[model samples]
Target chain A: MIAGSALYQTAVELNRRAAICIPEDARLAVGQLCQRETHSLSRYVLEQIMENYQVAVAEQRPMCADTGLPRFYAKVGNEAVVEGGMVGLEEAVRRATAEATAAIPIRPNRVHPLSRKDQNNNVGVHAPTVDYSFEPGVNWLELTVVHKGGLFGGDYRMLFPADGVAGLKRFLLDSISEFFRRGMSCQPLVVGVGIGGTKDVCVRLAKEAACLRIVGDRNPDPDIATLEEELLELGNSTGFGVMGLPGDGAILDVHIEIAYTHTGGMPIAIQHFCFAHRRATARIGADNSIEYRGNPCWFTPFYRRESISFQPA
Target chain B: MNNLEDLKLREVRLRAPLTEDDIRSLEIGDVVFLDGVLFTGREGLYSQLFDLNLQPPVDIRSLSNVTFHCSPAVNELRPGEYHIPAVSATASFRFDKYIPLLFERYDVRVIIGKGGMQKEIYQSTFRKYGAVYLTTVGYGLGALYGRGIRSVKDVHWKEELGLAQAMWVLEVENLGPFLVECNAQGRSLFEMANAEINQRFEKLYAGLPQPKLKRLGEVTSPTCEVL
Candidate 1:
């Protein structure tokens, strides 16, 4: 059986891994861009970001100080048995978050919205938010932890059905430009676009796309995939290279996820994931042994040449 | 495409208790590697410095040269002993209101942060106090941390504002390779970049087909180049 204590330990381990590790894919993308960039300042910025990634990973320190809000995506099997009920599981995760905040020593970034008060620990109401999905006939638990709390980048908009594809392109470009003007959301950024859903659904999808999809992944639908590529090219052309400097590539990738929407309205959310791209996934087997990997594989049916490191505990 | 091919950048080394001449010698587009005592503070600390009118725990004139606009990730071992693990620059314009006051009251000759500041504030601060704005690398926390930071000398309001927002006193050696965004002469690289980029954006936006605005939602257009 999967014990609540084991789940707690898993959460802490996931947080630690997410803080320290910059996936090999992001490094490769930045490294490749550095070679192509002609602007001395842009190249220098990319080099510096790369160096930071390497040092942080080796030292097991956070790649960025804004070790953002801890968010988790969990896939639970209906067939799985737990040592304690769902409430017990939530309590374990919360305890683990406090432990990781101290152990990984991430800055306490949470505060009460109304009172403007901070606990000096990265815990608050509905924080370290978890999105759950149940899979039938499987007896394993899959949890993916994403560091989405960074204040660097995020924006959303709802459009009339008449806005169409051109609307998406315009809105997205404008949003990226606005973010660039406001000091940028720490580039080379991963852009996620959610189209054709309700406001909440599109925003959530965009966040998932930003935090979950690996760089270089494409949408399964050909038309959506084309839009993603077009947006990526356009965003990169903004000349807001690394740190709003000048460079060839501003965006690392653009992932678009879509769903059916009202005939009169189309909601689009444009979410930016900074270069940190910190995430980790773990699977707790029915036997209670945990296996871990770097990415959550949210956008499957895509290609990734980089290998995922699986550690068993 | 504002060809920076001919951008001549001066290389400089700055020490704390910087003088008017030291600030004057700098120009927009110059590069500086700073040496001396540096301190960290951000939005929360800015309120303490300006709104509250409360004195900082450390004598401002004693450190007296550079103040970084950042809230670093720190690990506190005890009451005073702390380990700075990661630090990155934040947007400067967020605290533009307090910046001029910082230069006026304190002997701060240079302010370090990322994403540059508004032209009016930079020009005013420079004209009045000969203070300059230097931009450190953004999103490169490890590189910033790797600089010759000696130790955390003191901290103010850790209990109230939390570690990131708390004011910190630090001693540094050759602590930067900062890009000069604004100089003591009141020239700003950010303003220059904006003008050039805006012109390019204008051209780019013009190339796109104009849409007919028939409804409230569709009418929202990209306001040109004024980030």
Candidate 2:
């Protein structure tokens, strides 16, 4: 059984990693963008961003002061068992979040929405939310933490089936036009598109698509993957570059995620993962050995299975 | 990697408590780094000073004429000692209503933050005060900016406003790579970029059709900004 202590320790470490380190996948993408960028001003901005990444790692400081809203994604194995079950694991994560806030010295951004009262620990009612998905044939628990800025760059809309792919493209363009101006969304970033499901689920999938996946990974479905490539091309063709300056491209990659929804409505959501792009993942084995990794491997075949039943591949 | 020094963008450095000439000399799109002291402020400080009519805990004009819209990743190392590892600007557009108060009451000459305010603010308030706005690059270069901070000059209202919302005065050496988003002449770099960007919007939207249904208060014009 995985001890709660191990969970707590790993959670703290995940927070620190997410706070200080820009994952290699994101780093490489930005590095390449900086090198190929043609516009002098946008290229200069990208260069400074690259330098900031180096300084953050060298000095062991948060890449972004906003630190956004810190949250977690947990993938649980069918055979995994913990010392106190799911509740204990949650407790461990919550305790670790508060501890890491003060220790890593990340700004305690969470506050009471109406009262605006701050606990100064980044923990409060429904703060630092944890989302979960399950997989079969393993006994390890995998956790990924994402620190995403919330003020801008996410929108949802309902479209009829008749609207189709053109409508989807239009919506993506609209979001880009809305938030990408003045670098409000902080461009040269990833764009995540969620194609279906209930409104909330669609938004959630969009966020997960943006935050959970590694830079280069694509959806396994061929048609959806093609859509991802098309949207990416369309997004980059906007002539919007870093800080909303005109240049080669603003988007690093486009990710599309989908789920079955009501027959009449084709709801969609768009989320932008900015250059800060801070996230980290780890897998805790049944033996309690923690292995850190850049990729979260969130969208398993089982997780996206369409049939009523799920089977291990 | 390309050498940043080779870039053609004009760069300038200025010390704080700037004079009218110091502010007016800046041009839109010029890169800037700042020296001397600056303080952090946002809605909390704004409402306190403007709404609550609370006198500033310290003398504002004497401290510095520069204020940053930011909150640092800081920790109290000892009873009154603090350490900040990273600092980045917050979006300044939300505090638009307080700009006049800051300029008139505090005589603030320099504002540094992320993004920037609407063009109207620059034309009216900023132009009148002879102040310029500098926008932090990457909008998240917390570590790079943090390195320029020489010391924590003071902190106020920690208990009342909480750490994130409290007023933090910092002494900085070369604190930025901020771009001049809004200059004293009331020109805005973002507005200039938008004019060029908006020209391409028509072609991008030409093949796509409007949605069958629209939400209330939806912006129909592709070229219109929602800000």
Candidate 3:
């Protein structure tokens, strides 16, 4: 029998992962405004996030007080297996997640959107999206995990039209603009542009796009890269000030997952991932090929708050 | 919060341009019950206006001491209905897009939102044109209601964004428990909150290995600050 110790350690790591986030500077700005200020309106929502952080800590409460439906992304190596790793990976994650949550005092934020009753953050039919990209010969439990707790679950959208005339930039701009007009706040305004693929595949592809590893950076493809740049610029210009800042706001990264799309049309839909992007993504590689990029880098991230005694003047 | 019976509200059409003479004379706290017509455009409208290099949909010259914000009307509105309330939806951020334009093209004054604003916009627009931004309750939709018959006018990007409708209404007694942060002057608590989230993100990511350092207070962003 695979001893349960492996499960315990993994859970601890996941808990640590829960409290951390790595939103890039640009993307961070957008998230703040998108949360309350709306998208397309401001350039400096990240500033508001600093103030909000103070509120979350001073209150000693969950940020936004809306702990989200837990979503974990665990990347594992092909050769490196947990010693006595017999209990299925899914079970290990589920079990570990439950225990770690308790240890960290993570808020019981999972609630039925309709019923308004807390679910105590447990997995029902499909609570966590366990995504795995297999590495050939890596060993050791090395993974990066990040989750967005306060946000509402983001929706999954596919923006590819059958006619195929509307360019990617047009679709993305239209999608984001519409999201802001809805008048909702703190809702993660992430656009998962699934290109290529046929029918369902396109949507599935789009869903994958929503979980980009690099957050908001350019895509590898040249055509997609251009569109990404244009949309990013247009999104900030919407004058929708994020977190309520006036003009130009930081937006969470825009991700695009492209497959071989059908020739019929270009259909791009916008999916609003909950209030905070509480989904965590980490990799457990035995070979250690993937390393943290930035200085003082580690696979882990942190959360911040400040003294309320000193207010911004 | 007096009922409409006690409040002074009636509709008035724009016969000529409203000058500073109109805005300066109004009392500071007395609720200005506006009738006649106003645009119901939100973000898309803002984007379109930005594209056109203009202010809002209303005839600018005729707008003085006018309020600009996004609001959705609850309760069905018929052609000649007497009762309906236009509740403020999202406090807009696009005011920057049109604030200067409003002051320049029309001596329009007054905007609305759920929080305070930056000083420059306030001074540049309000100080110059006697305009000020009003902060309304962020989620007090039910609190604002009165009756007026109206419907949507033109929608720019109507295909994706629905009707950029127009509705006329009477806002009642508690126009809002909107946070005190909102006023014409300029200062955004929202900006501070955004900055806080960014800094904490750095600290949280850095301290992941040392999980013992985790404190719920440090782990999450705060909920209330606006007094």
Candidate 4:
């Protein structure tokens, strides 16, 4: 049986790393995007983002000031053994969140939804929210933590299935345009679109797509991948550039995650993540051994494709 | 389209109790670099400072004429001392209610944040108080902490508000490269950017043919969880 103490240790370690450094893959993608800036203002802003990452690494500071909301996605093995079961895992998360809040000193973002009371420890009602799935044969638990800063934006819509390809495109474009105009989402933006699932499933998938997927990677299905490509092109065409200045590098990538839904309704969720996209993944074996993986590989063993061109319309 | 090249730029040295002439000289799109003291605070601290009628722990008028909206991530080195670990800009629209009140009571000549503030504040309090709004590069928080800030002075509200929400008196040097968003003359950079995007959207919408949707089957009510 895995010790309860081991779980808390793992959670603290994961939170610590996710907060302090931008993932290696994100660094590579941002570097490539910076090289494509044609406008002087866009170039300046993009370069600063890169420089910020370097400083975060060098000084061991959080990559962004907004440490954001702490979210966990886990896949637990059905056969896995734990000293206290899943409840123990939940308690472990709470303890770990508190530890990290004091240690890493993440912003205490949790507050009473109505009373506006600050917990001051990043733990409150339904906080450090957890989503998990069970795999029957697996013997180890894998966890991915996504730190979504407060500035990120998202929405959900239950569209009539008849609202064909045109409706989908219109909805997506309209949302992006509104955010672009308001300068809501930070640029070198990452857009995550979820389609065809129940409303709850769609929203989670969208967040997963936004935070878990690598910047330059694509879905294995050619059709879904093509949609991602088109959206990326359309998004950049807005010329929102970096921090709402006019330029070409408005969006760095678009990710689409799909699930089968009831024919009666097509639920869609659009989630936005800033360029930081801070996340970390770790695996805990039945014997209590922990392995911290570099790349999240959340949905691995997928087909690889050539990188799409980002030419603005 | 707004052109950055045509924007008038000025380099101003920051100090407390700025003259009316200094505030008025700045206009929308002007670039500024600060060279003096500044302080940091965010939503919660604003509530405590103004709504709760708490007196500032330090002498506010002695510092520069600027205040930044940042709830920094800090690490405590000793029992009371701390070091800034990260810094980032936050939105100012929600703080609209208290900003004017702040200007009326204090000598704050310039406000800094990301995504700018509302237009009413700019047209009214900013113009009336002879103040200006500045936008820092949002993604450059780490670089800002490293290059811009020199040290953190005495911190206020650390006990109740926690580290992020606590008001910090910071000594800084060359802490800017802030874009003038709202100026004393009442021009707003955000308005120009918004208008430009709207104009461009009109063309984009007109050129594209609307996509039609076809219903495949029956309707089912969805049960969505609270996200």
Q: Second chain of candidate 4: TM-score?
A: 0.82
Minimum summed lDDT over a 10-residue window in model 2 chain B is located at: B1-10
Top candidate on lDDT is 2
> lDDT tens digits, residues A1-313, model 1?
8898889999999888888788877889878888888877678767778888888877777887776788788878779877786777777777888888877877778878776587777788997677876665679888888876455577777777777877777777777667765346887878888887788989888888888888888877898898899988877776666765555667889999987889988888889888877888899999999998656765443221123542222
Residues A1-313 of candidate 3 have per-residue lDDT tens digits of 2224544465555444333332343235344454554322232223333433333334322232222345554444446765445346667666665654444434344444554343344444465556544443446444334444322223233333532424444444334433332223442345556666565655554555554334545666677777766555555554444433333333455666555444654444334442233333334334322333221112111101134342322
TM-score of each: 0.91, 0.98, 0.47, 0.87
True contacts kept of each: 0.35, 0.78, 0.01, 0.43
Question: Can you list the residue pairs that collide in candidate 1?
Answer: A69-A149
DockQ of each: 0.45, 0.64, 0.03, 0.33
How much is the lDDT of residue A56 in candidate 4? 74
Say which candidate scores most in TM-score: 2
Docking class of 4: acceptable
Candidate 1: residue B196 Cα off by (Å):
3.0
Alpha-carbon runs more than 4 Å astray in model 2: B1-8
Best by DockQ: 2
Relative to the true structure, candidate 2 reaches a TM of 0.98
Q: What is the TM-score of chain A in candidate 3?
A: 0.67
The best-first sequence of candidates by lDDT reads 2, 1, 4, 3
Evaluated at residue A247, the lDDT of candidate 4 is: 69
Chain B TM-score for the candidates in order: 0.86, 0.94, 0.50, 0.82
Worst 10 residues of 2 chain A by lDDT: A304-313
